[model samples]
Structure formats: C-alpha cells, structure tokens
Target chain A: MTRARPLITDLLGGLVVTAIGVAGFVESWRMPRFAERHADPFTVPGLTPGLLCAVLTVLGVALILRAMAGRGGAVAIPILEWPAGSAQRMIFTIASVFLYGFVLFGNVPFLIATGAFIFIFTIGAELLNADRELGLLPLGVGALVLAIVAAFAIRFIFVSVFLVRLPG
Target chain B: MDGFFQFLHAVVAIGLSADLFVVVWATLLGIVIGMIPGLTATLGVALVTTLTFTMEQNTAILVLICVYIGAIYGGGRTAILLNIPGTPANAASALDGFPLAKQGRAGEAMAVATTGSFLGSIVGMLGLAIIAPWLAEFALDFTSFEFFWLAVFGIVLCGQLTAMDDPLKGWIAGFFGLLVAMVGQESLHAYARFSYGISDLEGGFGLLPVLVGAFGCAEVFVVMRQEATHLVASKVGNVLGSALSSFRYAKTWLRSGAIGTFMGVVPGVGEDMGAWVSYAAAKRASKNPEEYGKGSTEGLLAAETGNNAAVPGALIPVLTLAIPGSAPAAVLLAAMIIHGLRPGPLIMITQADFFYSVVAMVFWASCAMLVLGLLLTRPLLYVLKVRREWLMGAIFVLCVVGSYAIAGRIFDVWVMIAFGLIGFLMRETGFPVAPMILGVVLGPILDNNLRRSLSISQGDPLQFVSRPISMVIAALVLAIILFSLPPVQRALGLVLSRLPSLSRKNGDA
Candidate 1:
C-alpha cells in the first residue's frame, strides 16, 4: 500500500489555501463594479476570479476531509516528522539564493559578488557532501579560480555578445 | 505550386548564406543547454529569444526554432549517460537508454536516439509543411464560442493526459494557474484585478520569470535535496553502425512518429506525453516485452522518435490557430508575437511562407543534430561528470540574470523566487506543473472568448454549448470524463471482452 502523506502537512496546506481563497473572494467582490460603466452584466471583471476562488475553497475543504479520512476518520490531531540532513541543505540553498538575488547583485560589482558567491557556495557544498577526497585548501583554490573564469565568461557572453545590460 | 517554388527559393537562399551559420551555432548551443540537468528546451528558447531581439524577424525565429529542436533532441544524451533525463520529455528515454549505458552500449544507444530523432523530425516537418496551411484555413471558421471551447479542451486534455494518476489535482493546478494569470489589469475593462494596489502586480507576472523560476530554481532545490549524484564513463564506439541498425525498427519509428505528431496537435500535450504514450505503445506491441525495462533498443528508439517528432508536432497548432501545442511552443508563440508575426487563422494568408521557412529550419536543425550528436558524444560524457553543487550555483545565477533581463523589473525577480518555491513544493507533492503552464498561456484566450461568447448571446451561457464546433468540443470533453470513470471503464471492458469479434482479435493478438 502507498504511504499516506502526513496529516499535519495536508491539514495546514488546506487551511492556508482556504484562507487565500476566502481572501480572494472578498477582494474580488470589493473591486469596482461594472454598474458604474453600464457595461454588459457578463463583462464583470470579477466573474472568473470569483468563481475560481469558490472552487479553490471547495477543493481546500475536500483536501482537509481527505486528510482526515486518511488518518482513520476520527482524529483531528496533526502528525509531524522532520527529514534528515535535507533541512540543512534546503536552508542553505534558500539563504544563498536570497543573498545573491536580493542583496548581492545590484549592491556590488557584478563579477566580485558572483565570483565570491560561486566560490564559497561550491566549497561549502563540496565540504557538506564530502564526495571527493581533495584537501579543503586545494578545493577552495580551485573553486576560486573556476568562479573567476565563470564570472568573466558570463559577463562577456551576456554583456558583449547579447548586448544585455547587467546590474552593477 | 507557386507557393512551393517560393518556399524552395527561400530554402535555397537560406541554405547558401551566412545565416546557415546561425542554425549551426544555435544547434551546438542548444545541445550544451539541453545536456545540462537544470536547463530545458523552454529555457533554451527563452534565453535565445532575448539574445536574438535585435536580429531580423526571420533570422531570429530561425535561431529559436533550431535551438528548440536541437535542445529536445540533445537531452537524450544525458538520459543515456546519467540515467537522469536532461529535460522532462526525455524521461521515457532514460528508462531504456540508461540501462543500455550500464551495459557498455551507451554509444550505440546515443546513435539510435539520434537516428530516431532525425527521422521523427523529418516526419513532423512533413506534417507542418503539408498540413499547417489547410489547418489554418479551417481555423478561420472559429467563433468566440468555438475558441472558448478550444481553450477549455486544451486545459482539460493537458491535465488529464499529463497527470493521468490524479487528474483532479492536475485540473486544480491548472485553474490555479489561470487565476494567477488574472492578477493584472484585464483586457476588456482595464480594471485592476488580484493586484491588491501593488504597482508591480498591476504590471503582471511576466511568463519568462515564472518559467525560469518554476523550471530552473525549482530544479536546483530538488537537486539540493539529493545526497549525491553519480556519473559513469561511456565508451564511444561504432556510432554510425549502431545508428544504421535502428532501421530494423522502422515500423515502430513511423508509428511512434505518428502518435507523437497527433499528441502534439492536441494543445499542451507536447513531447513528454508523446514520448510516454509511444513508449507504452511500443511496450504493448513488442514481442520481447520482458526486455523492455531492462535495455530494449526498440523502446529507446520509440521514445526518442516520439519526443523529437513532437517538436514540429507542437508547432502545428501554434502556426494554424495561435494556440501552442506545448509549453516550449508557447514560448515560441510569444517570441513570434514579439517579432511582430501574429500567428492565427489569417497567418497563412498574411505570411504565406512562414510555415515553409519553419519547415526548412527544422530540416537544417535535424541535419545539425545528426552531425553534432555523433561528434560531441565524448565531450558530453565528460560534462556529465561535473558536480551538481557547482552547476546548481551557476544555474541559479543564470536564472537571476534571465529573470531580470525580461523588462528589467526587480519585481519579476521576486516573482521568480516565489514561483520557484511554489514549483518546488508542487514537485514534492504529486501535482504536475505542465498543465498549470498551459493554463497560464491559455488564460487570456479562455477569459476573452468566454466573455465574448456571453456577450454575443446577450448574457446567455447556453450559447457556449450551442455552436457546432463548441458542441463537438464539449461532447468530446464530456466523453473523456465519462470514460475515465471507474464504473464506466469496467463496464466497457466487460462489454468489449464479451464481443466475439473483439475477443477473437485479442485472442489472435
């Protein structure tokens, strides 16, 4: 038999979807109406979205019920389990992305930021995964060289060949 | 006859010029892009679209088409070498291709894949060349009601076909995507929608950012979750000899090509479905069915042919009806619109030679893939050895650059990140993303046609089902839903088994 998805995940996901859907419904209703413009009744801007929100809400409720049923129908309790090792990797990836996209690119010289990010990211990932036998210093040096070359190559391709304007 | 001669003349002109270099270069670039695990044919075309913005419209489109075709074909190499499909379309290929690689026949598998791709492309090109004009002419009769039905049918069929395991979830994802498309000022009213007073939301989520986010960043996160990746060395031997042996499966090649082309003509079904359905069909018909999952050459050929054929198959609807048959085709449609070539029923009348030009482009791309696939086998195998961590970091940078380059909107970058997270979550769950993409592309058409159909009938919704074409489409949709029901399926199976003729056919088979 297939393993059921944890109850907490589904229940929480359902609640979140339900909240969004209800909010969307309210907002769609609050939008300026076609009555002022004397437009066709069918031409209302909120028609599709209003309908979609209703559907989403219903689906959310169905999901909640399904999760309850999967938990043997009487339990309202939630289940939780943390994955091993993956949480760290996920956190690191998200943080690195936020730093690169939100904080780094426009704030500093493009090559410096990109090179540093790549070098550090590569070295960190290599150490964490530990698939290779190279010493840390040697790997770090190789990563830095690779990062420098990659940064320059990307700049030349995007800026010169493609004529794209890059953030400073 | 005159059109044919003109098309021939155009082909000859292009064949002789420096512009052919564009085809060669794009094909090579496409192969590299496709061989990368995170990058897809859609991304390759989208990235190239930006680079070709300043070129002539014809040349620009040619570059994109070549890249699209080459990328789809090129992904087979990674599937064979790494047991990881370089693109989602190559998933079926990995089933047989990787097993062959494990047996030291990786080069042979690559050769078969290339030959199949070339033949499949030829079949698809023929369909586009001969059928697109007629299909465009027929599409001229479509009204608001028919268009509305077509959009719904596209979304429903895509959801059902792509997410066969759980189509309801597929549909929810699709409708959610449609709602996402409704986030900006609408076309008819110019009224702000789900924007919530945010100026960036009013401008709307650009497709490029959403796509880059969904396919690229999301992929990085998935790879991050994996503990390790393994790469193996492949022996390159007798590529031509192995490729020639694929001729023994010519019937499977042709049948799979036809199946792929038909699937492509169904909007949003595209290469992945084509490859999977063909693979399934080949397995069903094979004499050595037990050999299928364990390294069957015929299985590899069918999948490769089906997907590569789907490239041109996907183009058929785009050229004829301004509707994309697949996600990559949606990007192609967008690129065409940016180049001031609006594809629709009147495209055949307005731009008579465009279809032929595309056919010629596909032909050259096939030739390029055949040459490059043979030549670049060893280098690609070497590339497969690159660690995912470094590559993932590099890919994220490209994603940022690609997202920001579209309209120079910082808001779009944020959208990319948000959607990337959403896409990752969706992947972790069983929800498919392809249908959502189709819905996003088809949302405007659905919205506009629904409103227009209603208006035409003076607020009566019944008119949607009243029109002839609309009725046919509605009936087809209803039929599919009905057949998919478990009780009905079981009943039909029993009835069919009881029928003497069907039973005899089954028994004979």
Candidate 2:
C-alpha cells in the first residue's frame, strides 16, 4: 500500500540506467579520437564521457543487485501517493505544458498564444476544483480577466521592460 | 581592514541610493513568493533572474541576493501558521512552529523565527566576508588535478549528504546530470556528442531553462497532483512584541546560527539540512528535550535561524569557487555569469569591491526581512489563503516566460518542459534532484580538468592524486563512496551495535 511500485520500479530504473550507460559508452567510443591529426590521445573528446558511462554502468548494476536482494524495498518512493482525482489533474497538466511548449509557442502571436493558453489553463483547472466556490459565469469571467492581465503583464515584462526579443 | 572599509563604503552607498527602495520591494516580493507553498526559493530566484537580465550587473545581483535571503526567512511563516513548510528548507520549522500556533502562540512563534533568521543571516554574512577571501587565495594554487578532484568531491559529497538514506539514487542522479551536460559540443573538439544531427543541440542545454523547468514547472505538476492544504491559525497576535521577547534565548540562536553557517558552506547541502542539523543540536543541548516538538520557542528559533543563515553560507562557495552551496545558489552562480561577472579562484583579486557589495547586500536584505516580517505578520496571512487552482496557471505561465526570456528561443522552452518532466519523474522515483543539478553545473569543470590533467600527466591516473590537496579531496571522495556501500553500511552498523554490549561486559567483568 505504501510503495508506489515497490521493487519493480527500482528494477526498471536499473534496467534503464544500465541501457543508457551502455548506449552512452558506445556513442563515446564512436566519437573521433583525432588520431589522424596526431592529437593527444588523452585529450580525446570521448575520454571523460567514456569513463563516466563506465562508472554509470557499474552503479546501475549495483542498483539492480540491491533490488534483487530486497534491499531498499522497505518504503515507498516520495510523491507517488496522491489523493483521488490526481491522475486526471496530472495528465491535463502534462498535456497543457506539451501543447503550449511544442505547438502554441513560436507558431501563433505571442499575445494570443500566451493568452489563449492561460485562459484555457485557468478555466480547466477551476472546473477540476472539487470545492467550487464560483458559479459558471463568475468563474468564466474571472478566469478570462486573470488570463488577460497575467498574459499582458508577462509579455510587457519580458519584451518592453527586459528587452527580450520574444517570438511574435 | 581594507576589506572592512570597502564593506562599509558599499553599505553606506547602497543605503543612501535608490537601491534601498529596490531592497524593500525585492525582499517583499521574495517573502510573498516564499509564503506560497509551491514557489520555492530556487524557483523564485530563477524567475527573478530573468527580470534582472536588463539591469546593471551589481543591481541584478542585489535583487537576487535580497530574494534569496528573504525567501528562506519567509518560508518560516507558513510553517508556523499552516503546519506546512512553504519551502523545503522550512520543514524543520514546522515541528515547533505549528504546535505553538495550535497553542494560540502564533505571534510568538513568528517573532522567534524572525529574530532567529535575522541573527543567522548576520552571522552567515560575516562568515562569507571572512571565508571567501581566504578560500579564494588558497584555491589560487590549485591545478587542474585539484579542480577535477574537487568536482568529483562535490558530486559525491552532495549525493551522499542530500540523499542520506539512498546515496545510490543520489549518485545516479548526479551522474545522469553529468551525462546530460555532455550532450553538446566538447571544449577541445567542437564535435557535438549526442546532437544526432540536430542544429539546436550544438549550442547545448541552457542552465536557466533547465533550472526553470526542474524547479518551476515541476512545481506546477506536483502542486496540481496533491490535495490542497488549509491554514490553521486564523490570527497572528502581537508580532512586534513577541519578536522582541525572543532575544532572551540568545544561546539557542547563536549555536544554531553557527551550525547553520557551517552547513551552508557545504556544497549542495543547503538550508534544509542547516535547519534540521541546528534543530537536532538544539534539542540535544536543551534542558527540557520533551518541549522540543510541542510548542518550544527555542526549537522554532533555531530552525529559522539555521535556514536563513545558510543563505549567506551558501553564497560563500558561489563567490569564491564558482560552485553553488545550494539549489538556489546554483541559479545565483549562473546569473552571475549571465551578468558578465566572473566568479572563481581569482574573484577576490579581480572582484574585491563586488564581493564586499554582496556582503552588504546580505545585511540589507536581513534587515528588510526583519522589519517587513514583524510589521506585516497579520496581513501576510492572506497569502496563504490563495487557492492553488487560481495560482497554478499564472505560475506555469511565468515558468514558460522565465525559460523563454532568457535566450528568446522556442527551443529553450522545449528544454524547460523536457527537464520539468525529468525532474518530476526524478522526484517521484525518490532520487534527489540537487545532486543532479550540481552535476550539471560541475560537468564541464570535471570534463575539462580531467582531460587537461591527463594530457599533462601523459595518461598516468596516479598523477591525478599526486598533489597534497588533490590527495585529501580524493580520499574524501573515496571515503564517502565506501561508507555508502550497502555491505559496508551493514558491517559498520553491526560493529557499532556490538560496541555498547562489549563495554557493558567489560564493566561486569
């Protein structure tokens, strides 16, 4: 009940770490050593990375071993347990972030893109609020107002005040 | 003496100028941000760093320093009233603070916290002024070998201390951060390591964006995923009067401040540990240990003092060694570079006046926190009442803008989101993020130095530990790793458990 995934999470985490380590090491080995240019062998671009990936591989193995031995399986990892309705909230948050970062930004005008994102986010979050204080009309109006003010304030601060050349 | 004069000059100049007003507002802003549950000191400093991009260098650093100090102190108020620490650093404060609030002594608890924080900041500021110059001078003789070992030591020690229970995961995070830092072009060769033919990958990940993502955007997800918290104490009574009364427990604050300052000096292990260590020490030394978690004023004072003092304590390494002592200090270090200020072994010789100005900044920030905290105690409770649903959207938008404003690249925004997910996953998996952040900061230092050292030493690994300083640091790194191993830990536990029995048997004999 306490552990989110128990020994299985560590088992998976170890496998992933080990895979990353191997991939990284292989990639490092593929990097140029500049032997054709008679560059110093120790100064190869891949030297440090190769060494780090080797160490990582060993640590990953150790983690797997520990998990197999039932060590570190006593308690739950932090932030895994949550109240009801958390999954929906988390999924929505991830979706919103993805849409804004990958699609909305750099595609639409900064003001509209940012305002639309904020407005949608605010209203969506409020609707998810279990203890709703405001009715539909008031909530919509409030969300719209907040979105407009916050969006304008952010744009002004970044562009006009800070001189950042943000995307249109 | 010369340094003291420069310190005095900087203090007087800042006090007399328009910067005084900046101090008030910035510190106030930091308090409000800290008073909120999800906005951490790291996030606060990072968001504020974006704003300072257009200001003069010193002014920017000033704004950041004020925010750093104020945020640490501000978190204590939430711990007192809501029984939830506004920041991780204030978690220890809640042990005593909440009980006192439940006992209808919220005002007294806050007063003790304020006084403790002020004292801690002053003590830490003194440590910074005295320690930075000496450490800088000492580091002047360090070769690439020493620097390489220092990076290893920072990563290892940070991993060990930050994840006391699970050093394995901590080290994993640290190594992963180093790997992340390797994804761009190397220093000696301009070849991109893992760019995979992508154009944006050549320039590498921006530090600010990664930070904004990990601390800021990740905060949004965590907040949304959790149930909301409610405030306990509806009223904060007689703040000013209660504050003055805390001076009676001078011993606790002083001891905690000293311990806190030392903890701050340790790389990547910042204010949270500072408060915890100080609180533990205060409990150990207290005459009435039973009163510790049940409304003890002294415990609250120690926790607050220790955390606040660590703010200045954390700055010591950032100024002298270009290594951050905490997560927030990491952002500060990056901001220093952003503002065209070089911080390293030669900083004392190169930026003497600037160093003194930082000390003066800490002084002013502490004073501002004290004044504002005591006077506006009751009014500040309104901050805790704001609903998360209403606040999360604005906070997320700021995270986006903070990342974008840094380099004005949409790619950076993507990096922020990516790291935010990585950070969220890291937290959920029980891996400490600070070591990873520290690894990202120290990766280049580790890489360049190791490669350079090997080139000079002709591939002899022995040469890496030849120097006295390098040997000492190498030994420390080895010791930490060895002690953290599961077999070694179990053996030590068995031996320690047997020691008391052996002593008793000897007594019986």
TM-scores of all candidate predictions against the true structure: 0.93, 0.98
Please state the CAPRI-style docking class of candidate 1.
Answer: acceptable
Number of the top lDDT candidate: 2
Residue pairs in collision within model 1: none
Once all C-alphas are superposed, what RMSD does model 2 give against the true structure?
A: 1.5
Could you give candidate 1's per-residue lDDT for residues B358-442 as a string of tens digits?
A: 8788888888888888877777677666778778888788888778876877777788888888888876665677777787788
For A1-168, candidate 2 gives per-residue lDDT tens digits of 544366777878888999999999999999988999999999998888898898889889988888887778543465556666788789888898788879988888888888888888888887887877899999899888988898899888888898988787
Quote the lDDT for A93 in model 1. 87
Using TM-score as the measure, the top candidate is 2
Q: What is the C-alpha lDDT of each candidate?
A: 0.82, 0.89
Q: What is the lDDT of candidate 1?
A: 0.82
Please give the range of 10 consecutive residues that has the lowest summed lDDT in model 2 chain B.
B236-245
Q: Against the correct fold, how does model 1 do in TM-score? A: 0.93
TM-score for chain A of every candidate model? 0.85, 0.93
TM-score of chain A of 2: 0.93
**lDDT comparing candidate 2 with the true structure:** 0.89
